[model samples]
Target: MDIKDLLQTAIYQAAHKAIADGVFADHELPQVILEVPPKKEFGDFATNFAMQAARGAKTNPRVIAEAIVERMNETWMEKAVIAGPGFINFYLKTDWLYTMLADVLTQGENYGNSQAGGKEKIQVEFVSANPTGPLHVGHGRGAAVGSALVNLLKAAGYDVASEYYINDAGNQIDNLAASVHARYLELLNQEIDFPENGYHGEDIIDTAKGIIDREGDAYLAFSVEERLTKFKEIALQEKLAALKADLASFNVYFDVWFSECTLHQNGALEKTCQVLKDNGSIYEHDGALWLKSTAYGDDKDRVVIRDNKIPTYLAADIAYHRNKLERGFKKLINIWGADHHGYICRVKAAIGSLGYSPEQLEVLIVQMVSLYRSGQLVKMSKRTGQSVTLTELIEEVGTDAARFFFIMRSLDSQLDFDLDLAKSTSNENPVYYIQYAYARIASIFRQATEDGITLSEIDHSKLNLLTTECEIDLIKKLGEYKEEIIDAAKERAPHRIARYVHDLAGQFHTFYNQCRIKGVDRDLQLARMGLALAVQTTIRHALNILGISAPEKM
Candidate 1:
């Protein structure tokens, strides 16, 4: 058992024993929650178990704490003291550190892997941007967070499927087709007015050029309806292909590419509407179908079908979620842009009206990303002549730096991405800092090997030599990897892993500075080598989870 399990088990047994001995009135015990003390003086770990049990037992908190501390693991725990009105702080012996270090070395790359998720199936849909243009910086943020979330969930042992929902059935597709037609006519020296609401990105012109090169004036001979139908299919294919390539370059991939049109084509949208009608969750009002979303906590009822017998976007979304549940996923996670915040309530309400709990669907709203260069807010990419594209960002900074910067904060918080900082190779750049930690350790091993010293399997018995303050701090950080991944997965927060790996990097940097690994005593050097090996392995795994690279040599 880990330190947490040991303490919790001991505390539970002590509380039960206290009640049995009539030391306090019999009452239910409170759940134990332990946290590392913010400062070293507070002890290694702290818990408020006594504070929680005091009220139920009708006894003083210190008295309850006294009862719990008297029964902890004496072999590993040096002392358990009561502080600040019943919080129990545990100061542990150093022997546990040796054991933890040995475990780390043994586990190697799997040190942080946990089966906490119990293999429950989960679906994460993200970056469902329309195919009208290249993905902007905003979409990049969602892609990074979404892909990292998928990786994090899998690391926590979930049966995860990453997906991209294509908005192919909407007006956006029409606008794209119209835009391509206009560009195609212009390229062929024919006069035609572009649709006022059409996409105007440079990509439309490229699409027109590509079509002309592939089939010169062949489309012009067809009827306008036939030509539009063909263009829509061709443009969507090309746009999706380009989108896949860009995401692949950014190290993001999806298991499914679910199209919105599929819901309509397979009659799922109409089927769900009929189901809602039969259940009285929807009604006809003003010659339109309306969902009574207000009953399920939405601000107001929503229209599923308009007066023209056209299904609204919300109707398609309802069908999509039902399809997710029907596929047997226990949870559905959607990463959406911040502007979609108002749509959350009605969508969740739709899920409820369809006989599923709204809790099954979770939406993460990703805020906007503002790029800054030379202390000035950059609004457009000179290369694209529009909003900065993900491709542009990757080209300027790099995939590793871009992914790291996008997820440096929570999804709800707006990000001010510094173009200058991310490009810099200095310690001020956080991604470079973390990557350098891995490289620095690798260089140390190289130096050792060059001196005719070959590092073998870690001698677990030599771990006892690691006793310095720096060594303990590093070892403790190594032990924290498991808890960090578990907590990060529980909260659906990948930013926590970013923060954790950065902290781990800081600890390793300190340990390397204070402890001499090479030219030290043979046993001490081997112990330090074991520590360095574990730190490097954990760093690589953490960076991999974030979809970033940890270069062995910077």
Candidate 2:
């Protein structure tokens, strides 16, 4: 159970008691929603339930709050005070913190685990960038955010699956084939006109060069259509392989790799459009099939099929999303680049047309990322014939720092990544600072071993010795782990865990400076060691969810 859950239960019982005892007339009760106060003086946690229930109870908010607090008899809380506007601020006794530290030590890495999601199934599809080129920084940001979110949802006890949708059946593939063929002909010293608006990345030249080395001039003997078809197949396999490898290097792995080609095959796209028409969510105009998206709050009706009987990209997407629904995914989460913002409404409208609630599909848009070095923006040139590739970013700043920096900020905001800070060893680097905290704890254990103090067993009674301001603050931060995971998963925000772990590290740093373990009394020494183990467990657990590592030796 979450710490907040326990607090809420107590507050609820108190409110009901106040009603049963006739302290206030009860028509209905509002839910107790607690928030961590902005300042410590406001107490450990605060709730505005009194304000919400004031009108229903036919009383002032302050009177309702006072009634509830007067009846809140939970021994875990030291006191509850009424703040301005009838907010109830709760200050907890240290006894609960001591018990929580024991649990943290016992549970270890599972300290932050919870069942808040109730095992509800969800699918997260991200970085479905076309295989025509290498993944760039935009895709990298999505990969980092998407993968971390999957990990977080699972931690909060969701039945989650991560997926990568391969955009292999489209104009992009044709352009790739034509570009590779042109590059191949050029490598053979033959006069060739490159396909206009084709992929101009240097990776295309590399692919052509690789094909020639393996097959030699044998492909030249085939007809244009046959050779181009072969290039399409071989190039897709190679490009997809490289894409998977690059993502793997960043610690992002997908459970499923769905192909767009499958949606286009076997009359799937047409069948989906027919379903929309059957539901009266689609119509025809000007010899083209159109989706009545505007009826569902889209800017306007969108074209699904052209007059020439060819389906547009929107048609494929509609079919693809329907397939996801048919596969029993209760929820579908798509992580798209910022440019796809306008498409959200149409996609949701397609969901409603298919007889499903548009709310079932959640689209997370990852904004742009700008790299900086030495206080100047690190300009991206036509590297790999495009912006910075994911591989280049990983090689430059390392996987851990790159992933952390990408995830530390909210997804909806533009991120300015500092290249020099990521590469630096100073405390200003958040990743370095976190890992150093873990190392500092490990160093304490090493020193204790030399001093012949062993944590063979924890004295449950000695846990009360952790009474200093620093120790109490660290315990409070550690106690927040489960609550943090619950809120982060519910809000669809993985950055919350990043912030929580950073603050936990900060708390431990303060504790280390103000407290000593090796020279303390034997009983106190063992208690502090137990606390230290909890800190180490939580840091590693939180970092693992972010796909970052907590090193014992900085």
For lDDT, the strongest prediction is 1
The list of candidate 1 runs beyond 4 A from truth reads none
Steric clash pairs (candidate 1): none
lDDT of 2: 0.90
Q: What is candidate 1's lDDT per residue for 224-322, written digit by digit as tens? A: 888888889989998999999999999999999999999999999989999999999999999999999999888789999999999999999999999
Tell me how far candidate 2 lies from the true structure as C-alpha RMSD in angstroms.
1.6
**Least accurate stretch of 10 residues (summed lDDT) in model 1?**
450-459
lDDT for each of the candidates?
A: 0.91, 0.90
**Candidate maximizing TM-score:** 1
lDDT of 2 at 270: 82
Error of 2 at 508 (Å): 0.8
